[model samples]
Target: MLKPQMSPTRELISLDGLWAFDIERDSRPQAWTGTLDSGLEAAVPASYNDLFVDSAIRDHVGWAWYQRKVCVPRRWTSDRIFLRVDAATHEGRVYVNDSFVGQHIGGYTPFEMDITDLVAPGEEFRLTIGVNNELTNITIPPGSITVAQDGRRQQKYLHDFYNYAGLSRSVWLYSAPQQRVEDITVVTDIEGTTGVVTYDVQASAPSTVRVRALDASGTQVAEAEGAAGTLRIEAANLWKPGAAYLYNLVAEIVDNGEVIDSYTQTFGVRTVEVRGAEFLINGEPFYFTGFGKHEDSPVRGKGHDDAYLVHDFQLLEWVGANSFRTSHYPYAEEVMDFADRHGIVVIDETAAVGLNLAVQGGLAGGATTPTFSPETFNDDTQAAHAQAIRELIARDKNHPSVVMWCIANEPSSNEEGAREYFAPLVELTRTLDPTRPVTYAVVMFATFKNDRIADLFDVMCLNRYYGWYVATGDLATAETYLKGELQGWVDKFGKPIMMAEYGADTLPGLHSVWDMPWTEEYQADYLDMNHRVFDSIPSFVGEQVWNFADFQTSNGIHRVDGNRKGVFTRDRKPKSAAHALRTRWRGLENQKPGTSN
Candidate 1:
């Protein structure tokens, strides 16, 4: 008999109406002061490709402007108003009433600006956002590049996915009272069988805060009291995977005799660590049987609704997947929260993908042009990475499901002068949260030296597509070659190994072993051989397929859309390989120790 979880009282203000857009040419400063007359129309949460019928406007890159008017209610004046953007690509400058408010550089993380001081109650205010995605002369990762098409080098970006740039996620206006909860961090020490909850509380005025922890049966287990700063709760009912005993935290901010602000969060107590290559959760060895998922759907690139999120998790659960990786980028916070409630382990990743190919030039065809050149790793890139990392961690740190902090995905270890760049970034992750292990997925290059950065990580993961990408037609030979590589790493580093990524691209409509690269049967066979290889390696800790769904990729070769490496179609239809992998994972989980199935 568990008490029902309290829903967060947050309102989403839809910013999906008509917006005016135009391209900017010169680098010189220009004011958006004149009467709004661009006339170009676009909708929110819709990409530029969705707006224009012309291929030029749909594909061309430059500066664009989005303008709209928003009104605030008179009664909402007593609370703090925040203008939040789910995501904006490249760089953007936000303005209110033609006055510059703030600027953000990242393309994937959420950012907010306090507009309480600038907004007037019950009045329509003009909000203008200037977005610039021009090809920079800098050498940082993810810049436009010229590639050889039909033996002629043509200009293209050195990224792995389609650049469907815009205000991609969501935009909203919300009001919170002046005195409220700023941040909350929950840490579990399951080895010691104890729980520590820390709340970084902020308030506009002085107030006393009382915190209480209640078990699933509504029994008060632990309590604490503090002023307007960090509050900690100790020795509480801990949370585990199968025995997921969660607790509810209720915070009461009282000034006089009245409750000023109240905040409640459901949290679980658990500890996750990497022992060599094996991951231990709550002092018991656990294997990650999971899939790599992108935040995209067939009809909507990233426009998935709440029901879709829940549906995706249900599918994973059905397949006996105990873990998930938010491939290449940070997912919506709600998704992580749901993972916590459902007892699934999560690898919370940053939006720092595609930076690898841009920074290192040799892997994708020995091209010398670097996207994120080491020369241009300046304050702007650093600031953007820092902000993205901070927001991602701060938003999802409290969830018990998140076990590892992935700094970047598939970055090159053979970069020119930045061979040790990943090491420092791994250190940065530890600085932020020393409790969880830090790791990154690296491409399986024979000459690639991971020792430079491998020591910084608690687990070593390899994104190998040996049979599919390297061997192509001979999966049996590819299996042998991949096993050699895995054994070599295990003997050398003695760390736990995870097949971070492995899958074959296949077309949804086709199914045959003869379909070299685009057949569902071929995909299923590739996974079968790889899983068999994994069975022989006892040091191998886990396996997550290359992807969970087919997604948009501007860099694909066979398909103009993207790679079809998913176990499911973009529309969430199950593939034959998905069912096979499900059976394999279930068998492994049910197998007895010391007996090979």
Candidate 2:
């Protein structure tokens, strides 16, 4: 039996109480400074739509103010107090005790502000946060239309998910010692049959670095030394997925022979690369058989506990999946850590969604027409996009399970100057970390046309929703159409391709062909068709279904409750299609070349 995984330490500060809120109209700088009595109770981290049923939080475009009071602990004062916001929609300005702290301009990336200077030990301080998501603001992306305050028209992107805007992830206050480990990077290099592991360490201060490699028995197999930088160790004990061999890397930041901070990261020494459309891991050909996953749970939204994440991982492992894609956005850091321990390959993505296609019009006096044309290509918009990418990479670059850095997921193919927008971002990722591959999910024909930036990526991924999105008649017809679309890119780009996302949405627990395409039966049949296509196509690398679990969607169209394309329900119950995929991927593990299991 495998040892139970240890959970990371966490403390959540409740923001779900009474808060003073005020909506601002058209202001030059969009500032909120006045203090007001708390009138209504709004849950922290919950969307404004969930609390105020009548408030036009979703379609309305302007500034919203949220104010609350928080008490700091006396012990926490000795260490540095950091206020972390996991996610805030659009743009935000944070203030502690009327003192400006910092500002962040992205909806999906995490940001932190040092509030130690602004707070008094064991004293209560008023916290104020102002958010502006106005559509007409040239700094922010424009919607399909611009509506008036009384609800007219505005510009917005046209999309298929709901826009539940607020602090969607979490807010927390944590204390770290002055000289703590800031970040870590683990890299595995394999030459012939020998494996070499190197660790790039970062610290808050100058400290001695002690590195140790341990085996399953807790015996030290290798040891090396360096100070506050890169440390290397060579060993023959490499790890493979099924073989389950793993090594523990312990790094100690020492100050005058006293340990100031220490961090232990578990990593397996293995190398992975794509060769002629086949993924070779540890010098052996491997295929990525998995699903795309969202962080949201049914009633919990994005507030699900660690048990939920672990339960989903257990289900994925049970179904014989070896890979997963963080569809649309980046997942929490702990989720990637779990993947590393379980030996699952992860494609870490930045938090960029349907910005190019969200409805442009507002509810009041904004524009009327929905614009699918890209508006995320502007200089300011591009800077905001790049910031999100950089934050994601900074937070997750250390995880060993992550094999690919995904820039975007199915951005608008018809957007103006898309190549100009994405080419530089791809280059930026390569500059940051050249060890891992960079990829973006593309639509069939629309994205492949631009070969100028196509050569920038190591692997090309296509988000093909053929049997579901288009009326391809049947699975065979869908397969034929998809192959024809991908063939051009494979020939022209000379890179391995992955069917990044492909799945059909269906109502859970509902069965029958009468419900045809929208029923569970249809979903299973769709997976069967996808498996056949993946198994037969030699030019394609592998496939990841549209989702691993049902998640919240804000699009006014298609996904009302959530995107119902998951192979598992939001609560982590398996759907029929999940088992069908297991049969195919597991069977592949036993089959030899030219032989079917």
RMSD of each: 4.8, 5.6
Taking the tens digit of each residue's C-alpha lDDT, what string does model 2 give over 213-304?
A: 77777888777777433334445566665444677877677778876666666777877676666566676665677888776764445542
For model 1, residues 1-597, the per-residue Cα lDDT tens digits are 011122243334667666877655444374454445767876676555545766655565655677888998776767677787766765677888878889776666667788988898788888887765543333223455453554422335545666666665667776766776555555556435456555445445666877777778887877777742332345555555534567877766777756666667678877787776577877667778888888776544554357788889888877778778888777766687678777878888886665545334443435365423545443455455666677677777778888888876765554553444555566677887888988888666522334346656788778888777688868878888888888877887778788889998877778664747667888888888888888788777788898888888765456646768888887788888889878887787765221111
- TM-score, one value per model: 0.86, 0.82
State, as a TM-score between 0 and 1, how close model 2 is to the true structure.
0.82
Tell me, by lDDT, which candidate is best: 1
Query: What is candidate 2's CA lDDT for residue 51?
Result: 56
Q: Which ranges in model 1 have alpha carbons more than 4 Å from their true place?
A: 1-43, 134-141, 145-155, 191-194, 202-207, 215-220, 227-238, 241-246, 357-383, 446-451, 513-515, 592-597
Model 1 residue 455 CA deviation in Å? 1.4
Candidate 1, run of 10 with poorest lDDT: 1-10
- Give the per-residue Cα lDDT of candidate 1 at 425: 64
